[model samples]
Target: METAYIKTPVGIARIEGDEHGVSVISIVDEATQLSPEIPNILSKAAQELHEYFEGERRDFSFALNPRGTDFQKAVWQELRDIPFGKTTSYMELSRKLGDVKAIRAVAAANGKNPLWIVVPCHRVIGSDGSLTGYAGGLWRKKWLLEHETPPVQHRLF
Candidate 1:
């Protein structure tokens, strides 16, 4: 596996992956430098992330090989299906998973997502339409959600 650190508006992001695909994109409070060897997988993941941050890319088409339990993997896959510029509640996700009572478990799975923006974990919110716990921090989550929302055009000249 290869690793690299990328600086973004939210914070320092650590990317890890291999030929199979990117496995993780995590936020760290401190900045850390990566080794000089840049693997192809890491390089591509970094480039795609940069495009995403620049508002030039809406969808990620790269392969992902995130490591997690079966339930966690299921939750992550569901998260990826969430459309861009849209949000879903934890309860909603539980319902989709065929267990409306598993809200807490769904939230737990979301919190463990290792793919970050690639998996679109930030698109999940609280049941009452509030920004909830995010592994990358709530402020960053708010920024990501706002970034994905389409801009409102005004008629004023």
Candidate 2:
């Protein structure tokens, strides 16, 4: 797998994948060195990420090859369907999967999502709208969510 590390507003992001598509992308510390030579595939991913952070893109368009079990794959796929700037709860996801009792399992899968922002696992939240666990840190999760949210309109009544 080809690996590339790029700096972002939140942290340094390590991207790993090949023609088969991106398999893993996780945030590293800001002190990490930026990749001097990015592979073709990883360069594409990095560019898309830059646009995402710049608010120029909402939905990502690229091939993904996340490795996981059948259940985990299903959960990750559902995470992709979450609209930009929208949030869903683990309970809601479990209901969508037709097994409310699998909330814990769904949460586990969401937490294990390897594609990071591309899969949008950060969109998942607690049932009470509270921010929950995030592999990249809750601060980064909040940053991602806030980045996706549209600016509120100021109306004079």
Return the top candidate by lDDT. 2
lDDT of 2 by residue, 101-147 (tens): 99999999998999889999999999889999998989999999989
Report every candidate's CA lDDT.
0.88, 0.91
Q: How far is candidate 1 from the true structure (C-alpha RMSD, Å)?
A: 1.5
| Candidate 2 ranges with C-alpha deviation above 4 Å | 155-157
Question: Distance from true position, residue 54, model 1, in Å?
Answer: 0.3
Q: Which ten residues in a row have the lowest lDDT in candidate 2?
A: 26-35
Clashing pairs in 1: none
